[model samples]
Target chain A: MLKYNFKYEWLLLIRNRWIQVLTILLFILFGFAAYNGTQKVKMRTSNLTSAINELQIKEREILSQLDSLEAGHELNISRWMMPTNPVVTGNLLPRVVNMPPKSTAFISTGQSDLFAHYVQPIVTGEDSTMNFKEMTSPTQLLFGSFDLTFVIVYLLPLLIIAFSFNILASERERGSLKLLASQPINIRVWVLQKLGLRFFWLVMVIIITLSLVFIIFDFDIKTNWMSFITLLSIIIAYTLFWFVLAFATNIWIRSSAKNAITLIGFWILFVLLSPTLINQISNTLYPIPSRTLMLNEMRSIKSEAIKKQDEILDNFLRNHPEYATNDSKQARGFYQKYMATQQLIQDELKPLLSEFESQINNQHKLVNASSWFSPALIVQNSLNQIAGTSTGDYQNFKRQSIIFSKEWRNFFKPMLFKGEKFKKSDYKNLPEFRYRYASVNTYSKTFWLIIISSLILFLVLTPNKHQIELIS
Target chain B: MILTNNLTKSYGGLTALDALNLEVKEGEIYCLLGANGAGKTTTINLLLGFLKPTSGRAFINKLDVVEHSKLTKQYLAYIPENLMLYPSLNAIENLDYFSGIANKSFNKKTLQSILTEAGLQESAFYKPVSKYSKGMRQKVGVAIALAKDAKVLLLDEPTSGLDPKASFEFGKLLQKLRQKGVATLMATHDLFRAKEVATTIGIMKDGQLKQQWHVDDISLSDLEKNYLETMSYNTIEL
Candidate 1:
């Protein structure tokens, strides 16, 4: 019976031109999404490269000035701004701490659109007060880019619903159901076979069209083949979830238009309403502190610390006598007082900043736990993780850059307090930033999706109370 | 063989089929004549096991229909008023599919042969059924019964909309099935077609069988007069 159903369904779909129309539609959707995603990645890479090259040029000029100063040559510069001064050299050049794009970065924009990929961290800047978010236009932020993730998470299920919604209802509407019921076969099994064949054909179309789009958009498939295969696995699983919903609606609903409306309602619930509702609940549960209030507190701490700079310096020298100069001149400069005041302000503001971090972390945990309620959220997070552009990735970048900023500041602290001269050898010892992407486990997500879809299919096929009600 | 004993069906206060009893043996066609709302369709639905009987039994080939609904369907074939086939499929494809569902597999040549034997032209066998007339579609329905080699055939108003030549051809096809010893029961409003094809005939009105007869014992004019008199409609000679 299944063999006959498969053969006839294939013939009908082909002869009716459904397959041809579906293939063309998929090609257009995938091609446009890939083009948008790849263009965004290209622009990010270009900006990061230019920042690094610009910093390298400045470093070379600083090195030449240091070489001239060491040869006892009188350079055309003021005494305070001399190359021999460690404070002057540290304030002159800063390192470009950056996070480069990952191999699968073109798969999704994710949080990449919200944050800057690189920052030039100077010795005197405060790590807690640094801005990592980009200055994007409000309109761009309101309506995000139409990338591949958006297409898969939002549009694919509507196509599946349109394809399989009328598999059984059309038979009854055409006056052939009585004839079909007279045969020695179960109606449920027949509907299953028909819908299963449609799902198989749709999967084939998706794989072929996605691969073609990647090739046309010049995606590096050879190097990112593992990510590509994982992507296809997630897509197949998500597709199965929607097909199972279609099967249930086809069995339970009695008319073609009613079946379509019911499936579309499911689509809206699972793909749109559930995720937004979960996010809203998570936020209400674990509220994040206001950035404006935190900034205001930080400003007050800095002004108070500046008024008491001398007393703060004296206390700092008493605690760390190693930074106290033994030279008889005991020459104190602006940096000597400024570094102490900055440290005092940072110490005062630590707990407020820690509370802010804790709240944001709690929000993330709440969102992750609640994401299980919606498959769209699960698949969206998986795609973002695969692309290495998730919110967690950006947070990790911010954390690492802050640690590197402190290290750069500490590297110059010893020379600034001890009042030592800057040397060419110290240039090579400056700190650099190296980003590490967080590891992801998408196989488990795909497995859970398949299991859920199978469970729904099983329940729909079984003869239960709901099945009886639907049939009657 | 097809048999029913005191079959009854009712909805609350209205009895659609009231204690109906009938039988069709091998090589016999029983024509059930009735008007609209006369329990003709209700009896057929009860026989098909599509509805539960209020009180009584129906059997096909000695198997109780309600107890072995799927099993009894193996020995019977049904054709509704307007038999529908897949519009996108040709006659041979539709035949192969319907036969395949009955656990019957046939080669293309064999399917074509069965269709031709059922009175469908060879040229129309490969054309899409969407372009076929009502008579051509009914011929395909007959071809399906032939392929299944059914022991019983149940039809509802199969000749209601056909022209004179098509109706005559359909009557001839029923005579051919009768020669094959297929017990057939058909519900219709045409007295002339029934008299020409049925071995025995019964007329029903208001959920009761008014009369029964062997086709040879009654003339066409007498059957028409009896039908009109039983229906309580005043008649005038032309």
Candidate 2:
């Protein structure tokens, strides 16, 4: 029976020239998206690699100049190696760590474009303002690219609906339904066979397209196998959801035109309207703090901490008795240093930074939890997490930047306090920024739950046999 | 065989088929004559299990039409007035689709022969039904019924748009099916054709079957006059 249905379905689908054209167009689109994604990833990787090499050469040249000037007892040439010099600081090459696109990254570019590729800490009091200049734009961040995930989640379902909405309704309208129903099997079996055939075709298309993408990109297969499978399963379940919707609509609607209209309405609601509305509602519910407010608060903390610099250093000495001394001149020398002021400012502003980060995380959590009502948002979030390109990545990056800032402060504070000259080897020992990619295991639960819920919805909403007969 | 025991159907507050009882036996040609909106089409729809009964029961070949819908459908075929087909497919393709769906396997040659047997023109066999005339489309409908080999056939205005020659030819096909013991239930307005072919004639009015006559008992002219008077519609003034 399945073979019979499959043969007939294949013939019918191929017979409709429009459906054939649509299938070809979808294949072309998928190929175009995958190619575009691969090229973008390659371009970024090349640029970052060359930039890191050039920066390393400059760093070595500056270090050599500093060493020669130090030997000659010349302060002007040695001063070029100071942390205050932007060229020296920029050439330090803060680890140059990048999250390269995985095999499935082509599937969903996600938030990779919105965030920065590198982060470095300076002697400034503001940690939030320390990211690369290239990552600060808001316009490109809002209007995203047309990635593979967008094609699967947004366009695929529409195509599925167009293919399946008239499956049974058209038969009835053409007066063949009654003739078909006068067969050996029941209506349930017949409809199930029809749906099963279409599902088989849809799955074939998904597998074919994804396989082509994998083969063409030659991406890392070892670590990405699970993510790839998860994406494919999600695609299947998502397409099935639309198929069930179209099937149910076919049963309820009397005319082919009515079925088309009703199914398109459903697509628009779930795919387009729901996500937009939910995003608006979430923003209205929990608005993020303005940058102006954050900056002003940081400024207030900096001023207060700078005013109490002597007191803060005294407190630090008391806490660490090993560093304490009864020699009044040495202690007075440490208290009068400029580095002591920077340390005092950082110590005071740590709590403020923590509070700000927590508030932003809380906002993210609200959005994540609110995604239950909109599958589009859930899919988007899941894709971003898989690609390691979400707002969460930016948050992690911010935390890393703060840690780098602390390391920078610690490295210079002792030198200034003890009145020692910074040696050339100290430059090599300076801390570098490193970003850890979030593991897929962290989000496996949410992903599976969404897939299960989508399947349940597809099953629960499919029209029953008796209802189909009556309506048809 | 088909049977309805006080079958009733209502749309909102208006009754379409009001406690009507009917039975059609094997090898019997039962023609129901009625004016527009007189419950004839509603009765056929109920027997086909398209609409549920408001009250009472309907059965096809002793199987309850509602409970054994699939079983009942297997024993019946329906031909609507318009005989719509998939406009994209030719006659042979349409026949193949419907026959395959009905689980009736037939080769291309056999299907073409069946279309010819149904009196469809050989030239139109491979042409899309969209280009076929009303009579040719009806011939395809008959061909579908023939392919199904249904035990009972239900038709609505089966001869409405056919020419005299085509109507006579369709009557001959009905007679042939009746001779083979296939029960036929038809709702039609053609009184002359009904008198010529129907073995049992019934007149329905206001959702009720008001009169019935066996062809053996009533004269042709008498049956026609009585049918017009019972339906309360005059074909000829004065």
Candidate 3:
């Protein structure tokens, strides 16, 4: 029975041009999304390359100046502007702390568009100065980029609803369902086989379309094979979720238009409404402290720290007397006082900073725990994680970048404190930054959840028990 | 092949079909005659197991329909007022699909022969059913029933909208099936065709079977007069 239904459904879909239309539509959607994703990634790469090239040019010129000055041949350079000073080198020639795109980064825009990929963290800059958020236009963020994640998590279910919403209702509407019911095959089983065949075909089309999109977008499929598989699995699962909803609506609702409207209502509820509602509830429950108020507190702390810089430096030296006693010169400079004051201010603002961090952490925890309520959130979060562009991924990057920034500062701190020179050899020992993504393997959970939801809906619409209601 | 013992169905206070006793044996065509709101369709629906009997039972081949809806359907075929076939599928495809669901798989040649036997045009065999006339679609339904080789047939107003020629052709098909000893129950409004084709006729009004007769015992005009009298008496009672 399943084989016959599959064969005829294939024939019908082909003859009616539904398959052709879907193929073309899917290709166009995937192609356009991939194009947008690759364009964004390309811009990021181009910008990083340009910045590195410009920095290298400056480095070469600075190295030549240091060499010439060391050889006693710097006639035109000013004394204070010299790179020979360790503080000068630390403040002026900051290395680029960058989070390069991961292998599957192009699969989803995720939080990529909202955050900067690279930052230049100089010794004078505070940890908070390494802002992760980019200077993108608010309008752009509001509308969002049309990437594959958006397509899979948001638009794909709508496409499935359009494909399968009226599967059984159309049969009944066309007056064939009664005829179908009279056959020896159970109607629900028949409907299941019908939808299952559609799910199979849709999965096939997706695998082909996504593979083509990956190839066209120049994604490294061989290296990111697991992520690719995970992506397809999530997509298939999410697609199954929508098809199950359509199945339920098809049997529970009597008319084709009514089935469509009901399925679409579910779509809006699951895909569109739930995410925003969850986020709103999370925010309302665990509110992020006001950034404006925090900024004002930061200004006041900085002001107070500057006024008490001498006293803070004295106290820092009193605590660590080695630097004071070991230096025979017994000298102090701008960095000595500034570093001490910076530490004091950071210590004062730690609680304020962690308040916001904790709230954000709580919000993330909320999203993670409640994402099961909506498959869209689950799939979207999974895709973002796969792409290595989720909010958590960026937060990890920022956290690591702050740690690296402190390490870089500490590398230069001793030289500055000892009032020593920065040699040409020191450039090789400068701290560098590397970004690592936090991987979460939630695909299995998401895939199984969607499949289970489909099965539950299937069992709920069992043939004999509810088919009478369907007829009525 | 079909039986109902005090079969009844109701929706709250409104009864769709009252207590009814009916039997249709092999080679017998039981034609149910009625007006718009009569229990003719209710009886067929009950026999098809599409609706449960409120207080009694329906059976096919001596198997209880409600308890064994799918099992009893093994030997049954049904055609509704509108013979709905998949519009996107051709006559042969629709026939093969419907018959295939009944566990009767047929190849192209066999399906085409069946459709042709049911009086579908050879030219229209491969055309989509959406383009076919109502009468042509009914032929495909008949072909499905033929392909299924069903022992009992249930039809609800199958001749309602068919033209005279199509109606005559449909009566001929029923006669052919009856000759093969297939039990048939059809709900219809066509008194003339019902008298001509059915082995026995039952007239229903307001969910009650008001009259029953063997077709040989009555003429077409007599059946019509009996139907009108039954309707007029219901109005008088009202």
| DockQ per candidate | 0.64, 0.39, 0.76
Residue A203 error, candidate 3, Å: 1.6
Better of 1 and 3 by lDDT: 1
Q: Can you tell me which runs of candidate 1 are displaced by over 4 Å? A: A77-92, A328-331, A465-472
In order, the Cα lDDT scores of the candidates are 0.88, 0.72, 0.85
- Give the B-chain TM-score of model 2: 0.95
* Candidate 2 local lDDT, B1-238, one digit each (tens): 8888999999899999999888889999999999999999999888888788899999888999888877787778788887887766789987877777777889999999989888888889888778988788888888888888888999989899989988898898889789878899999999899988999999998999999989888887887788788877676856
TM-score of each: 0.95, 0.86, 0.95
Error of 1 at A317 (Å): 2.7
lDDT, candidate 2, A302-374, per-residue tens: 6787777677767666654554445675464533333455556656667766676666676678777766666
In model 2, the Cα lDDT at residue A99 comes to 49
Candidate 3 residue-wise lDDT, A1-472, digit = tens: 9878888888877888878888889999999998988888888888888878888888898888878877878558665567887767877777777888877877788888889988888777888756778788889888998998888887888889888988777877767788888887777777778888988888888999889989987887898788888888888888877788777777667788888889889988988999999999999999999999999999999998899878899888877665564666565877789988888888889999999889989999998888888888888888888888888888888888899889988888777776778888888898877777777697576767677776868576654465576665
| DockQ of model 3, rounded to 2 decimals | 0.76
**Distance from true position, residue A252, model 3, in Å?**
2.2
Name the top lDDT candidate: 1
> Alpha-carbon error at A15 in model 2, in Å?
1.7
lDDT of 2: 0.72
DockQ of 2: 0.39
Q: What level of docking quality does candidate 3 show?
A: medium
